[model samples]
Target: MPSPEPKLIAGNANRQLAQAIGRRMSMHRGMQIGLVDARVERFNDQEIFVEVYENVRGEDMFIVQSTSNPANDNLMELLIIADALRRSSAARITAVIPYFGYARQDRRTKARTPISSKLVANMMVSAGIERVLTMDLHAAQIQGFFDIPVDNLYASPVFALDILHNFKGAMDEVAIVSPDVGGVARARELAQRISAPLSIVDKRREKAGEVSEMTVIGEVTGKKVIIVDDICDTAGTLCKAAEVLMDAGATEVHAYITHGVLSGPACDRITKSKLKSLVITDSIQPTAEVKACENIRIVPIAPMLTQAILNIWNGTSVSSLFDTATLEPIYEPLYPGLAFE
Candidate 1:
């Protein structure tokens, strides 16, 4: 017996990505869901308004919105849509956020500061989101911020497969490099799967858009280096790290980032950098400027997400879809009341 399809909804942020995901899911189970034009014009006092054209009563709803460009607006749109679905008697509402925003600000660096990621998580919970499905969050610990079931999908398997297919014979000579020490865990996982050596680029950032110097922590000399990261905002660190790797006698330097939130001259910098290639996921919609870059390549993850969604919907194990080398499957116990609190 086939399971009932979940309703798909899309907001203004990254409509094309949402449609792609919808099409992938629809190939198995049909859906009548469509994107509603969520464009809003500011009033004199500055208030936002939204309208949804589809009926979602008694249905399992998934609001697809990526907090990418105009992150605040996209976040608000998602929140409003969730609230609307809750009010419309939806059985379940899952926030399908491919690229979660404000994830970098998970902690307070200064006194009297707020943890923005926690606040966003709280907002989603308050907005009546039953679950969250996001990919390659900037900080993995951000999952703890949400009270709902949060699934953090990995884009590495997708990229690793693409790399193996497109850049064949280079795996032996290649070394997966982490853009920073913080991303060592992620890079190591990718490297292990690809059967390549691992390296790290130790970089110091004085401020936003500026990196002082970079040091290679492993033997990358004469090796093809592939830097992995969750997000690339300014491209400053990535380009600088590529420069350092090249100067350290690397044969070539490439980068594979999950989310290309390439704001403000990021594409331009990558185009002018020493990076051999820059591969990023379509988690965030690529702008015209990003599309114009010759070195940029987008690897699709829609098929992966669609399969996971189907597995979950059919009461099958979704974790079995990926090759998790070192990362353990963090699942909650079903029998929680059996003596374990």
Candidate 2:
């Protein structure tokens, strides 16, 4: 006999991404357990309310929520949904947080600063979340903040495949660059995968969210440089790095980011910057303004997330999906109704 399908719930945050993951689950794993009938609403004073209309008693439950913009509201909505699931007698509750907010606050640099990421993790466990699934966390050590099982997935394989496909024959002319010294490891992985040279934008920060100066570390003259990073909020660092790379003699500069937190003036900066293109994942739903950016593109990770969900259900190794040989290069775009061009 076949096993029972795991039920999925979508919070208000990134509902489209959750629905896409559900469709891919049915298409790839043949599991029809799509988004559970849940409605999240607000009251006159802006208090949140959630109702689950499905019969999910004793079922393995998963809630797909990305604590993106308006982080507090989305985070609270997730906790409330989890509480509802526990009250409904869900056997297991896994939070599929495609983009885990507060992850960048894993540690404190100044005195009396709260480690918000740890606090968030504790709240989730307190609210009855048994497991966590997130992609390309800003800091990997944030996984240690949670007491339950945590799966931190990477978007490297898809990115590597896309790079290999686009730069088919001229791999030598391509260079992978980290927008900052912190991201060199991530950039090096892609550089090694494609056998391209690695570079770093060595930058000095005078304060939080401000860079004083930047200098290129490696040879990037006359090469197509691709900047890789986990987050792109405000696009200040990204745009500056592009200018520095161009000044250092890069033929062109492109960016491959995991979470596009294009909060304020981000799209405008990218639109006016020297970047040839900016490729980001659908972890955070694109706004109308983001879609209007000419050089922005979105890649869907529903298939990969679906496989990870299935593996988690079966108690298998989700890391095995990273095997490059079994995967094919994404020559064309995956998600529809986004700026793919």
lDDT of each: 0.80, 0.87
Candidate 1 lDDT by residue in tens digits, 185-240: 99999888778899888887788657787888989988989999999988988998
Q: TM-score of every model?
A: 0.89, 0.94
Which candidate wins on lDDT? 2
How does model 2 fare in lDDT? 0.87
The superposed Cα distance between candidate 1 and the true structure at residue 36, in angstroms, equals 7.6
lDDT string for model 2 (249-339, tens) is 9999999999999999999999999999999999998899998999998878877787789889889998876654434422234322222
Which residue pairs in model 2 clash with each other? none
Q: Candidate 1: worst 10 consecutive residues by lDDT?
A: 332-341
In TM-score terms, candidate 2 sits at: 0.94
